[model samples]
Target: MLYIIGLGLCDETDITVKGLEAIKSCERVYLEAYTSILMVPKEQLEKFYGKELIIADREMVESQSDEILLNANSLNIAFLVVGDPFGATTHTDLVIRARELNIPVTVIHNASIINAIGACGLQLYNFGQTISIPFFTDTWKPDSFYDRIKENKDLGLHTLCLLGKKIYEPPRYMAINKAIQQLFEIEETRNQKVYTTESLAIGIARLGSSTDQKIKVGTLNQLLSQDFGPPLHSLVIVGSRVHILEIDFMRFFAVDKQLYNEIVKKDYGI
Candidate 1:
């Protein structure tokens, strides 16, 4: 059997009990390192699970997957992903390949930012569409996600922006400031108030991790100067103001205390 296990969002301990059992039973374990990352290292996971893990970066996973799947039909091979197994489209393809080979595969589910994003108090049901913001190159700045954010803002729905990530480097993070600047540039070109520097937004970092993980609420312009720690981050553009519960939840972070009142004043139509 081939098992695709979700390591959840944080560290080694985040794995579900069932997933842990599956990991132990497997003969070989492969961890895909490209799509997303965990706060803990591969060694920590190995120590906890007592399983020999092979790190599969982008090149390995995409170019040399045969090595991981070679004996899957005869041996129990396990492929691990940081979040839920289905979080990335690549894993879906792996499943497709397994089926084509007549290998019985099982997907072990766990927590992922896709669903954990509700920690910000934004109604998940109210989100219109999710978009990603990639790094803007000097000659290739793209605002393709701008229209999607506009549509969501027009409907008073929320837009979740999963920030771009570049691991294996020293700096290794797309800062929140850069994301805000890109949004401002898009707004300037479109000459639209769909979203502005003062527009309410949230920045999240190391979401499921225990240390230094937080959700901060502020305007894009206000968030421009703030520092959010770590590489894996996500931003949210809010469309509508609803219950007081959201405001309360956001207050845990300084940005919310400093900005949400103004956002509520404007977005709530008070």
Candidate 2:
């Protein structure tokens, strides 16, 4: 049997009871490290779960998956993911390969940023297509995601931008400030007025972690000035039609409550 388990959003303790049991029963355990990351290190998880883990980086998972699937038909192999197994399409492809090999598979689900972003008080149903913002290079700036964000904003829906992370390279994670700068560049080029420096945005860092988790609600210009420590950060663009209750709830995390209230009332017409 092959077990694909989600480690949830936080540290080792965030693993579900069923996931833990599956890991304990498995003969070999592999931790998928490229897709997303946990708050704690792999050593901490090994100590907590009392299981030795083999780190599966992008190269191993993408190019050498056959090795991972080898003997799965006879031996129990556990593939651990930082978030839900289905969060990344790569895992889906692995499941398909396993099925072709006649290997039975079991999936364990857990909380991911897709749903946990609701902690900011935005209605989940109000979110449109989520987009990822990759780190831009001087010669490789891509604004294709801008069209999707525009579509979401046009329909009065919120946009959730998942920043990119380069694990194998220098281990660079796209920060919210850089994301805002990219968005501004796109807006300037398109002139669609989708958003501006004064746009209401939310920046969340180290979500689901026990300590140093930060949430700041403010304009893009304001957020750029403030520091949100660490990686694994996400950004949200407020929709045009926001409920008063959401405004009230998000205000708790606002950098300037007065400015947030004014912007919501004047621009969002809440």
Candidate 3:
């Protein structure tokens, strides 16, 4: 049997009891290391789960997945992901491959940023299509995400921008400030007015961590100046459909409550 388990959003302890049991029962455990990351190291998880984990990078998962599924018909193999197994499309491909090989598969689900984002007080039901903002290069800036964000804003639905990260590269995670700068650059180039420097945005860093998690509510210009420590950051663009309760709740994290209220009133009309 092949088991694909979610490690939740934070550290080793965040794994579900069922996931832990599956890991223990498996003969070989592989940790998917590229899509997202945990707060703790692999050593910590090994100490807690009492099993040495084999690190699987992008190349191994995408190009050598057959090796992972090899002997699964006879031996139990566990493939672990940092968030919910289905959060990334790559894992879906893995499941498809396993099925093609006639390998029985079991998936254990857990909390991911897709749902845990509600912790910032935005209504989950109000979210539209989620988009990822990739790190821009001198000759390779992509503005496709801007169109999706505009489409969501047109419907008065919230936009959750999952910042991109290349684990193999230096500075693996995209910082909130860098994401804002990229958004600003796009806005300047397109001039669609989908969002502005004065628009309300929430910067979240190290989510699901008990102690290091940080959330800041402010404008794009405001957020660009503030520091969101470390990696694994996400940003949310407030839409016109924000509820009164959400405004009240977000006030707790606002950088400047009065400014936030004024912008919401001017842009979101809330």
Worst 10 residues of 1 by lDDT: 164-173
| Ordering by lDDT | 3, 2, 1
Clashing pairs in 1: none
- Which predicted model would earn the best lDDT? 3
lDDT of model 3, residue 68: 94
Global lDDT of each model? 0.81, 0.87, 0.90
TM-score per model over all chains = 0.92, 0.96, 0.96
Candidate 3 lDDT tens digits, 167-266: 4553368889889999989999999999988888899998889989999999989999998888789999988888899998999999988998898787
lDDT of 2 by residue, 1-270 (tens): 999999999889989999999999988899998778887899999998889999988888878878898899999999999878876444866888889899999999988888888988899999999898888888997888999989999999999999986656634688888888888888898999888899899999988877777899999989988888788889999888688899889999999989988988888677
lDDT of 3: 0.90
Candidate 2 lands at a TM-score of 0.96
* lDDT, candidate 1, 51-120, per-residue tens: 9899887676656767778889999999999889876444766777778888899989988878898988
How big is the positional error of residue 152 in model 1, measured in Å on the Cα after superposition?
1.4
